[model samples]
Target: MKYNNQRPVVIGVTGGSGSGKTTVSRKIFNELSQNSILILQQDSYYNDQANMTMEQRANVNYDHPLAFDTDLLIEQLSQLLDYKAIEKPVYDYNLLTRGTETIHQEPREVIILEGILILDDARLRDLMDIKVFVDTDDDIRIIRRIQRDTQERGRSLDGIIEQYLNTVKPMYHQFVEPTKRYADIIVPEGGNNQVAIDLLTTKIRSILMQRGNDKIINNKDSTI
Candidate 1:
């Protein structure tokens, strides 16, 4: 399939775990042309732990920036920006390691990179045209985390609580929260912030339109 010749616009959405950044990303995505957009989750790039035992994997501090295979993520994202397809990695929450399957992703006009620690890395930040941080209270975040982990991730309530207290909470303060300063936009209520979502959607559409105009001009100049 043919891809847009113009470079893709990359939008980075980052916030603490359970801060509703995914929801915000989805809202922005749905508002735009779905055919021209792709959402890339940072969680999908978790470091491979195949060499480690289950016990070792389980003990890993996943909330930390060091837990991500950021080099691979940057490489794949750069490929996408260059209008190349990629075999994106799949992360298994249950196994605490990379999954056996790979997802085939095609290049798109717009890419939304969403994750808790996406903004923590300078290389990732440099790739983004727009940087957004979804700000939510810690109390609400923990509550959401408890519900999501228990229901979707098959995590025990005790384990979820322990992980939150031991790593997730502290790591958020140390790494995730600090990245908010890098954001061009800060949505206070995540997906619930309709105004912010609408504004972002409008901005992305404008960028896409500009790219389309540039492509048209380039094609005309080629004919001349």
Candidate 2:
């Protein structure tokens, strides 16, 4: 059985834009016991766009580490580690702005924080019990980005290419790629690699079971 009161195992899933970090996160989430895991997106903690005009927001280099509200993310994760719930912000992809409402997240045994630049900060790195980076070809990632932005976010193909050229590619090399050295696991081909996913699932289960067993032993010992 899963331990409800056990402290969460914070897992940081990071990769370049369209590198399939989200897919990998979802696969891991699916494998974990139901109600025992929660997935948090770095996209949700984007710096609010209220101060800037839509034109300004359009020009913003979102792929950079500076674009994320890392301070707030740190605080939220700290709360999760303490077994406290959080009101996570929600971002609107179409408007490139933070939404008026928030998402209520309960503490769980596994907290999966998925994003592009998550590993770019040292403090954030310190909080992760496990860090995973999804590695994919640049061509494939750009194609995925183009398709998603155009189809889902109502962005034009030209606009996607412009932003990818001006911001995404450069930021990936500078901020995203360097962080790969910090990852505990590097998943190639993203979520389609069943071997990697299976190995990761096993590792997570082992960690969870070990922690659960330790808690039970401690409780019995304390009563004696």
Candidate 3:
């Protein structure tokens, strides 16, 4: 199906590590037609560290805003908004650097940008039509982080705990948590808040419909 010429609606979802921002993003993506929506993860924009030693890359604080290649992300997102395709980067968690492969992403009607520090950048915030913050407790976040790192990222429980204490927790308080004030909607308990998810999906569908109607009106005017 051909989407209208209208630019994609960008929704920003942010929260601390293991705060269920990814879960929220996936829930919204599932609610929409799969073909018309895409989820762009900020994790994919981590600065390439191929030249660095494994130890150096490992020591780099992944939770900090500086760890991301934000400029590249902004450029690629702009391309998508212009209804263009982009080669999205793939990050290797175990390698602690970007992978060699690229994923070709087509422009979609809806784009969900999910990350911990998405709201920390003003330029990113400007691109978003809606901003959402997932508010999960620190204890809950740490538990989730431990599970994800161990089960998916091949990280040891001891290493995860040490990193969380040394970097993630401090960075969240200094950078990520403060950005919650910028959010248009604050969702307590992240994806578990079904009412918020429903409301968000309804709003997104409404915008999509309005854009469709506008496209029809524009076509009629051109004929006249």
Reference-based TM-score of each model = 0.93, 0.91, 0.93
TM-score of decoy 3: 0.93
- Model 2 agreement with the true structure over 97-152: per-residue lDDT tens digits: 89999988766767788999889899999989899999999999999999898778
Comparing 2 and 3 on lDDT, the stronger one? 3
Q: State the lDDT at 108 in candidate 3.
A: 72
**Clashing pairs in model 2, backbone N/Cα/C closer than 3 A:** none
Task: Give the lDDT ranking, best first.
Answer: 3, 1, 2
**What is the per-residue lDDT of model 1 for residues 42-128, given as tens digits with 9 covering 90 to 100?**
999999999999999989999998999999999999998998889999998878999999998877777899999999889999999
Candidate 1 TM-score to native: 0.93
What are the lDDT figures for the candidates, one per model? Answer: 0.86, 0.84, 0.87
The best candidate by lDDT is: 3
Residue 64 displacement (Å), model 3: 0.7
List candidate 1 segments past 4 Å from native. Answer: 213-224
Q: Residue 173, candidate 3: how far off, in angstroms? A: 0.3
List pairs with backbone clashes in candidate 1: none
